[model samples]
Target: MTSSPTRQRGSKELWLDAAYEMLVSDGIDAVKVMALAKKLNQSRTGFYWFFADLNALHIAMIQRWENQNTQNLVDRCKADATNICTGLFNLMDCWLDPSLFDARLDLAIRNWARVDADLEARLSAADRVRIEAVAGMFRHHGFCDEQAQVRGLTVIYTQIGYISMQVAETRQDRLARVPHYVELFSGINPSPHEVARFLARHV
Candidate 1:
């Protein structure tokens, strides 16, 4: 909706997206209602129409992150579980796609969790759900439970670490190493088709 005074009606996403942008670019502390109102060029009254308070907006933001990052990641991985290579490729897509994944937001929430026990527990639960989903994908490919767990953790933790570290690498540079990384993570060299498919997305 337009932010003009004529009609201040706006969708929940409009407010949430503004808040998310602030969270990612300026950290969670900057996601206040006043900042959001200013960012959207709308009056503070519009915010109350959508969210009860700053805490409500924060809860909505966290829920959005959980749905998009954790639940959706698991579902995508499971969708391609018939082929482990494809499944791995799908899982890696979360790392490669900005529209699908927001590393900045991920890291920001993790940092937020460090001091908030409830948020920490939420993140911990999301981690477990993600790990199990990836591990199930591996198990579907015939890996034993223990091996699947290890490989699952390897893939999940590796991506988290890559994101958490804020690694600096050009798109082409990372794409160049995709094949080798896939093989190392899955212990099976990706087929020419798989490699091409992956590079096609990232590059």
Candidate 2:
């Protein structure tokens, strides 16, 4: 018989996934090594095979967030687009698709940052990188540096408000609103062809 997920040996990925889930679902205090072992239905000894200690696992979790949430959004911001609306739609895809960005992880990290200066600094650095990518997108599409920066800040800050307010909405609900959002953020309505193209990917 196949081993159940709980019965499987502790791999690095498994340990990190459990740690990440704990971090997101119940905050960093709940991400203890013993607790992660319990969640995985494995012994503490098995966790040691993958992570030297709780702190190592915590670092791995933060790295995962940096890769999965922050880096992905920055990449999407720089993705190919024929127009500003199309470009903003790429950014919207990151927001609407959890696979592109883990909103819960982002929120949890922000909450944890409230108590940790090191983490807050890391988060601030990531914010700068992501906001600049958005600004760069605007600059490429014809906005001046100052205008691009303002629009970029507005785009990211609005989404931060949404994520901080608990991840915006369901995919279908949010998808319906993307065109209006893209228009408002870019100050130009997307053509029917552009809107159709963007919506087709999500729908």
Candidate 3:
């Protein structure tokens, strides 16, 4: 059989993408250089031509994830015209959708980081980026800096906790309970007007 054409991504970009997929689907242990090369239908030579080794690839993956996903989200929030709650809710909706690259990879990385110190540090850095973005949004919505920071951490942590808890729950069950959780997090009694306003601003 003829060989598959050498996959063409910039040297750095290709490895980053491969590492991201491996980490997401399997975990950090899945990100071997040879494995990545095989996944790309290439030889180890292809990987070596770019990265010095697997550790180098891992570092590049962490940096690329931070720049592209974490930083990008922060930038979007900074630019959003919606109020803090609306912007944050929109963010949560995006995170819960598996189709989004950032969210899918984030879930994978978070899972992997649970047992790996280096991975945990990378994940923590990304989390701080998100927390700061949320805090800025809250400040824009009339919260003082210190209060916004606290509220932002609470909102972010609550969202993460909810998702983690729902990992084994039926989608229907999770969907049914989302509003209740949202209400609790937002500290607002359930009301059609408030939800309408939230959707109008966010959706």
lDDT of 1 by residue, 1-203 (tens): 54464367466889999999888887887888888888887889889989999999989999989988987788777874447777788877887776677788899899888877999999999999999998999999899999999988998898889888999998778777767777887888888988787778775
Return the TM-score for each candidate structure.
Answer: 0.92, 0.94, 0.71
lDDT of each: 0.84, 0.89, 0.68
TM-score winner: 2
Q: What lDDT is reached at residue 201 by model 2?
A: 91
**Candidate rank order under TM-score:** 2, 1, 3
lDDT of 2 at 78: 86
lDDT of 2 by residue, 38-130 (tens): 888888888887778877877888899999998999999889999999999999999768999988899999999998899999999999998
Better of 1 and 3 by TM-score: 1
Ranking by lDDT: 2, 1, 3
Best by lDDT: 2
lDDT of 2: 0.89
Reference-based lDDT, residue 151, model 1 = 89
lDDT of 2 at 115: 86
lDDT of 1 at 134: 88
lDDT of 3 by residue, 31-147 (tens): 997788788767788787788888788778777667766776676567655454455555555444443226556666678778879889878887887888878887887878888
Candidate 2: where is the Cα deviation over 4 Å?
Answer: 1-8
